[model samples]
Target chain A: MKKTKIILGIGALAIASFFMVAADHIDAPAVASGTADITDFYAFQAEDPNNVVFVANVQGLLSPSATASAAFDENVLIEFNIDTTGDNVEDLVLQAIPRDGRMYFFGPTIPGSVGVDSAIETNATQTSVAISAYGEAATATTNAGMKFFAGPRDDPFFMDFAQYGEIIAGNATGFNSPGVDTFKGTNVMSIVVEVPKTMVGGSGTINTWVEAKTKQ
Target chain B: MNNIKTILGAILISAFAFNCSSDDDSNNNEGSMSIEPDFSGTYTQQDQMGRPAVNTVFVSAASKNTFNVTTPDAQGAAFQPMFQANLEGLSPAFANPGDMNALMQTSADFTGLLATDVLNLSLDGETTFFNPATGALLTGRNLTDDVITIELLLIFGGEDFTENSQLSNDNVDANDKPFSASFPYLASAW
Candidate 1:
C-alpha cells in the first residue's frame, strides 16, 4: 500500500510539472515555436441540457496543410474527472484511448483514488465505444445512462492573432467585445460523452474537471 | 431679470450635479471575474501518431497574461484533460486529425479533442515524421505535403489575477508562437 502511495505521488508530481504550459500565446522568439502547444479545456451542458460534454484540444496555430498530417499520442489517457460534490475530487471517471483505427472509451465508473494516483476500475460496469474513423461520423454508446463518441474532426477554437498582437504591443488597450479568433479553419481530435444529469450529481451545482493520465 | 435667472440656473445645475453624483455613488458595482488558471499544476498529454507515445508526458500551460492554475486541487482523481486532435466548429465538436500529436488550446468559438480527420491530415501532420515512430507525418493528405493547421485548448483550472501582483508564467502558448518549417514538436508551461 505504501508503494502504491509513492507511485501515485510521483505521478502527481509529474503531472503538476507539466500542468502550467500555457495555451497558445507567444511572446518570446525561442518559445514561439511551440504555439501549436495545447491551449485550453472546456466542459458544459450540451444542446440537450440533460447531458454534459468535455472537449480537449492540442497543437495550436498549424497551417491547414500542416494540421492535415498530425498524429495522436498513443501513451496518453484522456480521462474525464467528475466531482459530484464541491470538493473538486473525481467521484466517477471516463477514460478514452485509441487502438488501431478505432477509438475506445471506458467508464463513468468510480475511480480508485480521487487525486494523484488512479487505477482503472475494471470491475465496474465497463463500456467500450468505437470512434468514428471519419470526421463527424456519428457513432454513439449508451453507458451508465450516457452516450459517448471518440474520433477526429475540425478545430474549433478561434482567435484573431493579429488583433491580439496589437493589444499586447500596447497599440490597443482592450480587445473588441468578442475578439477575433486566430484558430479559425483548423482541426482537433475530439472525444465526447453525454451523461444524464443525475449521473453527474443531484442537479445542484457541481464542479467538474478533465485530466490526461499517463502510465507511470 | 437675466442676472437673477443665470444665478438661479447655476445653483440648480450644481444641485442637479450633486444629486447625480450621490446616486452614482450609491449604485452597486457588479462584474464577473475570470477564474485565472493556475500555472503550477500539470496539464500534459502525448500525441496519437507515435506507436510508442512520448514515454514522458509534457505539461501544456496557458499564457501568464491570459490563464494560470491558481489553486491545485486537494483531492486527486482528475488528471489534466488532454486532447487527441483538433476539432472544428462549435459545441457538438467535430473531430479532425490534430489529436494524435499535440494538445491545441486557444480562446475561440470552436475547440475539441486533439485529432483531425484522416482525409484532412497533411504530410507535416503525422507524428512519425518529427516524433518518428511516434512522429509520422501523414502523406497524400492534400495536393501538397503540407502542414495542417491545428487548434489547442489549455486549461489551468482556477487562477488568481489581482490588480497588484507579479507572476511567473512558464507555460506560454499563443497563436503567434513559432512553428518548424520541416518536422517539430512543442511543449509549454505558464
Candidate 2:
C-alpha cells in the first residue's frame, strides 16, 4: 500500500476565520487536486416521494476544456455510507467504480467491514451505466428499482466565496445583496443514485455520508 | 466543400465504429466472470463528506486529514472542542453569552451536532437543507436549495433569524443552472 503524504498549507492564516464555504471544494491539501477529491454530497427526496436520491460530486472546479478530458479514475471508488440505525456507523453502503467507459455500481447491501478502509462488495446486487461524455446526451441505467448515473455535470453548489473572503479578511462586514456566484461556470464529475425508500431500511431517518477511496 | 464533407464523413465513421466496439465489449461482459473486474483488495479513504461545509468550516487546517479519516461515530468526541472553539471564536452570533442558533442550540450543542459530520436525512419527510418557510431542517439537500445561504442563516442568523443582519446570509441565493425535474437531475456540464 502506498500512502501519499500531504504537506499542509501556509500556517499564517487563522484557519477558523477562513471559511472555504463551498462544501469541500477548497479542501485539505491531501486529496485537493486529485480525482479522489469529493467536492459535495447531496441527498434529497426524489420526484417520486417513495424514492431518495444521493449525489456525490468530485473533481470540482473543472473548466469547460478540463471537463471534456476529466475522467473518473479507475483506481478510485466512490462509496455512499448509510447509517440507518443512527449510530453514525454505516449499516449499508453503495459503491461505484469505473471500468473502461462505464461506471459499475454495487450494494445497498450490508458492508462486510466499515470505516476508513473499504472492500468492494462484489457479491452484492450490481448494475452499471455507460459514462456520458461532455457534449452527449446523459445516460442512466436502472435495475431492481434503483437508477444510477455517472458523468460531468454543472456544479450545483452556489457560493459567494469572494465576499466570504472579504468577511474573513475584515474588509467587509456583510455580503452584498445578490452577491456574486463565484462558482458560476464551474463543473464537477458527478455520480448519482436513486433508490427506493424501502430499500434504504431506515426507521424514517438515516445518517449518510460519501467517501472516495483509492485502491491500495 | 468536398474536403469538409470528407472530414465529416471520416469523423462519423470513427464515432460509429468506436460506439459499436464499446457496446460489444459491454454485451460480452454482461454477467460473466471472464471480463468481470477485480474488486478485491483494500481501498484506503483519502477524502469524505456528509453535510456540506461541516469539515471545511470547523476542522482546522492541520487537522483536516485526521478529520477526513475519522469515522463519523468517533468524530464528535474527537473534534467537538475544536468545532465549538471555532464557532465561538468566528461567528458573532455565537459570541454573546447564552446565544442560540435558529435551531435553538447553544454553541456547544450546535457544535456537537456539527462535529458528527454526517448528513441526517429523514427518509420520510420534506427533504430540505433548512427551509425557513416550512420549518424543515437538514432533512436532505436539494439541487436548487440555497445551502450556503441557509448555512449562513443557521450560523449567524439568531434564533428568530433577525440578528446580525449583515452576517446572516450569503446573498447568493440559487444555482447558476436550473436542475432537471426528473431522474439524474443535475444539469449538463458547461
Candidate 3:
C-alpha cells in the first residue's frame, strides 16, 4: 500500500471565529454507507488547554454486529483541512489512512496544492498506530506531543431526524423538548488526533474542516 | 460521479478479494501470495460537508452532486438561490399564508452566509453553537451544542429573533455517552 499523508491545521490567533456545528448523517448515494462517508467532523479545545483535538468519524450508523467486522479501507485518505487566514483555503492538512492493520498519519504540513485536490507530502512528520480492533482495549500512540487513535466509536451526533423531517414537510410545527435520538445505538469509524496549538499555527485563528478523499 | 466511482471500486475490490481467498487456499501459505494493494492515482471528492444540515436543509436531492463538489468559496455563487428557495419552503416565516417571511432579507446576503460551508474555530473564547441567552453567538461547535436548533432559529427566527419558539429546537441535547477527559476523547463504540 502507498503512503497517504493528511494535513491538519490549528490556529492560535488572538481573534475569534464564528462557531458552527455541521454534520451530515445522510450518506449521499455515491458513497452511501461506504468507508469514505464522513458523517461528522469535530474540532474542539482539548482538556489540556494547550491542545486542540480533531475528530473525524466516518461510515456512520453501523450496528453492533456490523461494527465487529468493519474495518478502515486502505485506499481512502481522511484529510483534515486547516485554514489559518480565514480564506477558506487550507494552509495545512493532516492525512490519515490505514495499512497492514495499522493507521499511518502524515503532515500538519503545508500542501503543494489545495482545494478539491491534494498531493502526498512524503517528507512530513509521520506517525503510525496499531489499529485498535473491535472489542479490545483502546490503543493510542503519542509522538512529539501529538496523540492519535483510530478505531470504532459510538456515534456522538444527536439528531431527531424524524422530527426534523416532519417540520420540513409542514406536517409539524416544532421539535419536541428532550427529543428522541434516531442515532442512539449506532457507531462510526473514528479517527482522533490531539496536538498542541503551537504545532499547527500558534497564534492565528484558523478555520478547520475534514475531507474523505479516496485515492485515485 | 462518486456513485460511478464507488461501483467501479466495489467490482475491483470484490475481484481482488476473490483472488486473495483463492490464492491462500491454493498455496496453503499465509502471506505467500503477493496481493499488492493499489492506492495510486488521484481520489476525487465524492461528498463533502462543512456544517451540519446545510446540505440536508438547503440543497435539493438532485443538486447534491453539484453542491458536494463545489468548493466553499464558489458555493455562494452557485447554490444561494436554491438555498433561498428551499428556505422559503421550510421556514414558517415564509409560509405565513399571505405574509412573506419576516426574515426575508436580500437573497444575496442571507444565502452568502449559508453558502460557504466551513467550520469557524474560535482560538480564544468559548467554542459554541448559539448561546443567545449568554449573548455569545456562532463561535465554533462544542460536542454538546444543539446545532440543529440553532440552524432552525437562524432560518426561521426573524429580526427580533422571537418569531418561532415552537419550531426551533429538536430537543436531542447531548451525546449517548460521555466524552472522555483525555486524548482521543470520543466515547467508545457499543
TM-score ranking from best candidate downward? 2, 3, 1
Q: Taking the candidates in order, what DockQ does each have?
A: 0.02, 0.61, 0.40
Q: Pick out the ten consecutive residues of candidate 2 chain A with the lowest summed lDDT.
A: A1-10
The pairs that clash in candidate 2 are none
Give residue A37's lDDT in candidate 1 (0 to 100): 32
Top-lDDT structure, candidate number: 2
Q: By TM-score, how accurate is candidate 2?
A: 0.87
Kindly report the docking quality category of candidate 1. incorrect
What residue runs in model 3 are displaced by over 4 Å at the alpha carbon?
A1-22, B1-40, B94-108
Give the number of colliding residue pairs in candidate 1. Answer: 168
lDDT of each: 0.39, 0.87, 0.75
Query: How well is each residue in B94-164 modelled by candidate 3, as lDDT tens digits?
Result: 55433333245544456677788777776665666667667665556677777877777677766555778
Q: Who is ahead in lDDT, 1 or 3?
A: 3
lDDT of 3 by residue, A3-83 (tens): 222222123111111111126765455665678878887877788877788888888878899999989988788888888
* Best-to-worst DockQ order: 2, 3, 1
Please give, for residues B1-190, the per-residue lDDT of candidate 1 as tens digits.
Answer: 9999999999999988866665565333432222211112232322211101111112222322111121124211122222222112211122333322122333121112211111111212221112224534321111111121121112221122121111111122233223222111111110
TM-score of each: 0.45, 0.87, 0.80
Candidate 1: residue A39 Cα off by (Å) = 3.9
Give the C-alpha miss distance for residue A97 in model 1, angstroms: 1.8
Candidate 1 vs candidate 2, DockQ winner: 2
Q: Which docking category, incorrect, acceptable, medium or high, applies to candidate 3?
A: acceptable
Per-residue lDDT value at A117 in model 3:
68
Q: In model 3, how large is the Cα lDDT of residue A216?
A: 73
